[model samples]
Each structure stands twice: as C-alpha cells, then as structure tokens.
Target: MLEKLRKLANILYWAATAVLIALPIAALGYLLAETPNPNRASALFPHIDIIASPTGLAFWSAFSAGALSFLLFIGFLWSLRGLFDFYRKGQILTLHAAGAILRLGKWLIALALVRFMTLPTQTLLLTSNNPDGHRQLAISISDHEVGFLLAAGLLTLIGWAMNEAVRISDENKAFV
Candidate 1:
C-alpha cells in the first residue's frame, strides 16, 4: 500500500513539474517567434515582451534562468520522493530519518524563498516604465505575486513540520 502511494506521489510530482516547465518554454517559444510591442506589457510579465525584439542576450538569459529553475524544481521533486518513501516505509517515525527529512525540508524551503525573492525584481524589470503610471500597478502586481509565493511557502513549511512531528513521535514510541 505504501509503495503504491509513493509511486502515486512521484507521478504527481513529475506531472506537475512537466506542466510548470512547459508553460515557460511555450511562452519563450512564442516570444522568439513573434516581435513584441515595445510599448505594451506582455501577457507573461517579466519574462517576455509581446512586441519587443527578442535579442540574443535576452534569449540566452531566459534560457539559462529557465534551465536553472527546472533543475531546482527537479531537485525539490526528488527530495519530496525521498521523503515520501521514508514515510511509506515507516522510517519517518524514527529520529535519524526525521533529521534527514528536516534537512531536506530546509533545502526545499530555501529554494522557495529564492524563488519568491527573484519574482519581484523579475516583475519590475519586465513591467516597469521609466515614466508612467504603470509603474505603481506593476509594483502592486509584483507584491501580489510575492504574497502568493510566501503563502505557498508557508503551507509547504507547515506540511514539513507535521512530517517532522510524526517522525519524532514514532521514534519516541520505539524508545519506549
């Protein structure tokens, strides 16, 4: 039963990752193919312009950033797989496993934080104009993105903590 559950989790994680990766790639491809309007905001803010020429530098930068983000996302998914495996095997109830899980959790949290931090700068660069009323709106939208990211991060952290508690409880039971 546990093995089945682990496999399900892994599949779900990969599916989510693939969808997330596809979104950016599709947008990037569209930007490369179409000349964006320099005076207008892109549908995907901070990543591609709807009317601006896709410069070599911008293309490479976006590619690299996307690659890095994909790698990080993979790492998180793998860690999650491991954590799920441990839980399924009842190892999560042990102290040793708990410590390892906490470490992995911390890394995941850090990744989320890094992602959240970059979003604002990315948004500002993508949407801000040197002189316009749109700057404030851009900032506002950025703030909303940041808020959503933080909320998601917090939820993830809470789940990790709950797992930690379960591990600790299991360890205590074994000791007793």
Candidate 2:
C-alpha cells in the first residue's frame, strides 16, 4: 500500500510540473504571435500594453520567468527521480534524499514570496495613464509577473513537501 501511494504521488507531481512548464511557454508564445502595438494587451497579464517595440528589459524579464519555471520543472524531475529510486530500492527513509526534497520545497517558497512582493507594483505600472505613470506601471507589471511565477513555484514546493511528508510518515510506520 505504501508503494502504491508513493507511485501515485510521483505521478501527480510530474503531471503538475509538466503543466507549470507548459503554461508559461504557451503564454509567451501567444505574446510573441500578437502584433506589437501600444494598445495591445499583454499576453500573460491581459491589462498591460505591448508597447511599440519590446524593450530588452521586457524580453529579458519574460525570458527569465520562463527560464526559472523551466528550471523548476527540471527540479521536479529530479525529485521524481529520487522518489523512484526510493520506491525501487526501498530507500524512502534516507535522510539525504529527504533533505534534497525539502530544499526543493524551500526554493518553491522563495519563488512564491518573490512573486507576492511584486504583484502590486506591476498592477500600478500596467494601469497608469501618464508617461511617468506608464513607466511606473510597467515596472509594477513586471513585478507582478515575478510574483505570479513565485506563487506557482510555491505551490509546486508545497506539493513536493506534502508528498515527502507522506512518504516519510509511511516509512516510519513500517518501522513501528
């Protein structure tokens, strides 16, 4: 039963990771496909304008968000690999592996906090009417995107933690 539970957790974790990676890519692709114009809505955050030309900062920001998300997906894969090793080798209780999983959880939490902090700034930047307002709004929007990415990361981390705890608890029971 413990083995079956672990397998289920692994499946869920991988599936969630795939969805996380795919979402940003899809959003970015859609953004790129849209003809750039000052009046155009943002691909990811619908309220923001596309502006006449994409700034290096905007491009880099998007790239970074996508890249970070991709990296998290890779981390998820690593966690899955560890889980598989535990399942096959009955090594679930290993402290080293559990610690690695916890580290991943911490990363996710950090990502989420980053996102939460910037969301308000992004909202202000995206909605401002004047030139100064627009600039400020742009900054705010970028912050908001970061915040969203972080939130997603946090969710992923939470999921990983839950799985790890479950596995650890089950392993402990076997000893008792």
Candidate 3:
C-alpha cells in the first residue's frame, strides 16, 4: 500500500509540474491572440450586457487581471506540488507536508480575494468605452468564491490537526 501510494504521488507530482509549466504559456497565448475569445469575454464579464471589444486600456485591464489571477493559481499549484512531492517521498505526515497544505489553502483564499476585487474593476474597465450612461459598475459573488473560502477554512483546520498529530507523535516517541 505504501509503495502504491508513493507511485501514485510520483505520477501526480509530475502532472502538477506539467500543468505548472503549461498554464502560463496558455495564458500568454490567450492574451496575445489577435481576436478576443467571445466565450471567455462572456465568462469574465457575466453581468455586463455590452462588452466593448478588447482595445487600448480595456485590453490592458483584462490582460492584467487574467495574468494576476493565473499567477495566483500557479502559486496554488506550486503548493500542491510540494505536498505531492512530500507524499512521493513517504513524508505525508511531516511538518513540511502540513505547511504545504496550509500554504495551498492560503493561495486559494488569495486567488478568491483577487478574483473578487478584479471582477468589479474588470467590469468597469471593460465597459469604460461605452457612453457615460451606458457604463456599468457590476459586483458579482458567484458560488466559486464562497466555495474557495469554505475550502480554505477546512484546509486550515486540517493543517492545525496535522500539527497537533505530529506533536503528539513526537511526545509518544520521547516517552517510549
């Protein structure tokens, strides 16, 4: 069972590493593409009825938001990769693994926060080209943000428990 887990962890570690490399490339392609992706625009500016085509400041605003969010997600993946590395080495219960998990949770919360702030800003920027009356200030809080917060809280608790377990295990070894 232990060997199986180690092999699985090894596979996952490589998978995460691959994604960690691919994500930035994908984001760069998306940003540099001559034509805006309509589906992507719709997803990003869900509340806006009119999405001004990507041009000038509007394009920069969207680009910055997308890049920043992708960076945060990459950080999250790095943390996850750390945990997988630990598991691959049969160090799942170590402090390092717990710290990695805690960091993962923090990254998730950070990504969520960035997303919250960017949504309104992106909406304003994307629609800035519109006539004065047509401009919008949209605020959206989808289920995704709520879920991220909830998952962060859960991971935090688990990290705390892992710390306690490590401490207790150490004490047991000392007592023996």
Candidate 4:
C-alpha cells in the first residue's frame, strides 16, 4: 500500500508539473488567436450573448479576467504539486504536508471566489462590443462554484484533522 501510494504520488507530481507548464501556454494561445473560439467564448460568458466579436477594450478586459483565473488555477496546481511531492518523499503525515493540503484548499476557495466575482465583469466585457441595446451585465453562481466551495471546505477540514492527528501522535511518542 505504501509503495502504491508513493507511485501514485509520483504520477500526480508529474501530472501537476505538466499542467503547470501547459496551462499558461494554452491560455496564451487562446488569447492570441485571431478569432476567439465560439465554444470557448460561450463557456467564458455563459449568461451573455456576445453579439459582436470582442475587440479593443472589451478584448483586453476579458483577457485580464481570463488571465486572473488562469493564475489562480496555477496557484492551486502548485499547492497540489507540493502536497504530491511530500507524499512522494514518504512525508505524508508531516505538518508540512498538512500545510500544503491547507494551502491547496485555500487556493481552491480563492479560485472559486474570484471566478464567482468576475463572472459579471467578464460577461459585461465580452458583450461590450454588442450594440448598446444588446450589451449585457449578467451575474450567475452555478452549481460548479457551489460544488467547488464544498470540496474546498471538506479538504480544509481534512487538513485540520491531519494536523490534530500529527499533534496527538507526537504527544503519544513523548509519553512513551
């Protein structure tokens, strides 16, 4: 079981590393493309109708929002990578590993919050190119965000439990 866990951790560490490298490049490519992919645009601004192609101020505003989201994801991945590294090193029960898990949970919450807050701004920006009457500012909180928050909360609780476990183990060792 220990060996299998270590092997899985090594795989996760590399997967996280690969994503850390690929995410930015993919975002860059998406942003620099001559025409935004329709599906991606829809996914980005689900509540708004992008009647006209984003350009100038609208483009930059949407770009900034996307970049911020990408950065948050990168932070989350970095924390995950750190946790995986600790597991790979057979240090899963250490305070440092628990801290890394806490950090990952925190990062997830931050990401969810930012995404929640930015949805309206991103929609407004993406639709700013539409005719005056067609432009929109839409606010939405989807199940995805709610589920993300729940997961983050659960992970944070687990981290706290792990910390307590470590403390108890140390106390027991001292007593012995």
Please, what is the whole-model Cα lDDT of each candidate in the order they appear?
0.55, 0.56, 0.80, 0.83
The estimated TM-scores of all candidates read 0.47, 0.48, 0.82, 0.82
Clashing pairs in 2: 111-150, 112-150, 115-147, 121-140, 122-140, 122-141, 125-136, 125-137, 125-138, 126-137
lDDT of 1 by residue, 40-92 (tens): 34543444332443344443443444456556766665665566556556554
| Model 4 weakest 10-residue run by lDDT | 34-43
Report the alpha-carbon TM-score of model 3 versus the true structure. Answer: 0.82
What ranking emerges by lDDT with the best candidate at the front?
A: 4, 3, 2, 1
Tell how far residue 95 is off in model 4, in angstroms: 0.3
Model 4, position 173: C-alpha lDDT score: 92
Show the colliding residue pairs in model 4.
Answer: none
Compose the digit string of candidate 3's lDDT tens values, residues 1-176: 99999999999999999999998888668667744554356555566655455456675776588679888989899889989999999998888888888788788888888888887887777777667687777787879889988888788778878878887888999999
Question: Roughly what TM-score does model 1 have, to 2 decimal places?
Answer: 0.47
The candidate 1 region of ten consecutive residues with least summed lDDT is: 132-141
- Name the regions of candidate 3 deviating beyond 4 angstroms: 35-59
- Candidate 3 shows a clash count of 0
